[model samples]
Target: MDRGGLVVELGPGAGGTTRAILDALPPDGRLLSIELNPHLHRLVEAIPDRRLIAHRGSACELPAVLAAHGFAAADAVVSGIPFSTMPRAVGARTAAAIAECLAADGRFVAYQASARVAELCSPHLGTPRVDTELLNFPPMRVFRWERTGG
Candidate 1:
């Protein structure tokens, strides 16, 4: 895949996936990571990467935050948020926000504990394709969504 567009990451707990994206993207590509936890933000920030910018905020504010950064859209939005831990209302709102931030052809990739796929999909803004990954701790399912229509 081309690595020339902006990438937004939601709920990157400690920058593990963030590191992977940074390594994959070109120098001209930009990565904006939103982390809700202050402690996690500090840990993510310690990693030296001019391409990575960690925002201390919630995923629900993704669209506005990306706009404030002069980005109207992103090529992809990857998430590692703990959807199972969120209340239904918040989860629904966050899901909406995620859909809003993506460009028409943009992709949203999220990783959730295996047991939470049904719960997570219940509030998703668009249809998602889920793939289970038993290699992860506690095992996980990767959900991918692509906005339909341009």
Candidate 2:
């Protein structure tokens, strides 16, 4: 959150947001992208950046993934997963992982078409700061959840 040392992006489909996050990183910054789909994972992996680690994994495994990458926690996490369409149990598990894997001052950010993530993530990620982006084709909502006393 504060200048970004290690960033994690969940479900980086086609690398659109990946490019944005990579560009925002400082020289010492690194981004770990977790994409489940083989095709989309390959697309993100094709991006030529020394700082990007495109992994074929699910967000539910974030703790293990980060540990495998030699990171205890992330500075910030960005998710593109559509929690609204996913089963509540699955979404809760992934959301919990995001919270647990975040550093003390870490942030959990999500860009979703619906507001479902606000309810799904708040219990773990604390209060959310939300904004609407009407510029997109279907107008998506952006939610940033920061860590607080849990």
Candidate 3:
């Protein structure tokens, strides 16, 4: 990420991806991670990066989360959420909040095991393009949804 830019992360179940994001972030950049499960939130908090903020909250609470953290929008967002396994309505609601939080040129990157997530996010995040990460256990599909408009 660009130096000093803001990036939001959702469902950081484990610290693996969180560590990767932190490593990639420029010293001045920040990553606000929202984890629905308190247990997982604490695990993410154990990551020692100065740029990371681990919050215990649902993705639906994104607006308030950002506001409380002094962020108006994000340069980029990442999610490890399993939208396909979640309630469609809840996924849509979370997607809407993410749409509102993204900067004009920002992208929402999701690691999905199914196509349902991309379909669910399309209305709020625009169509997503896919890439495969073959090295993963089940081979992950990475979907990227860019901000819908300029």
Relative to the unseen true structure, what is the C-alpha lDDT of residue 135 in candidate 2, on a scale of 0 to 100?
96
Candidate 1 lDDT over residue span 104-147, tens digit each: 88888888874353455446545678898888777788888776
lDDT of 1: 0.81
**Top TM-score hit:** 3
TM-score of each: 0.89, 0.94, 0.95
Give residue 108's lDDT in candidate 2 (0 to 100).
84
TM-score of 1: 0.89
lDDT of 2 by residue, 1-150 (tens): 335489999999999999999887886789999998999999999999998998998889999999999999998899999899988898989988988889887778899998888887888766899999999978889998776533
The predicted structure with the larger lDDT, 1 or 3, is: 3
For each candidate in the order shown, give its overall lDDT on alpha carbons. Answer: 0.81, 0.89, 0.89
Lowest lDDT 10-mer window, candidate 1?
Answer: 114-123
Cα deviation in Å at residue 71, candidate 1?
A: 0.8
Each model's total of backbone clashes: 0, 0, 0
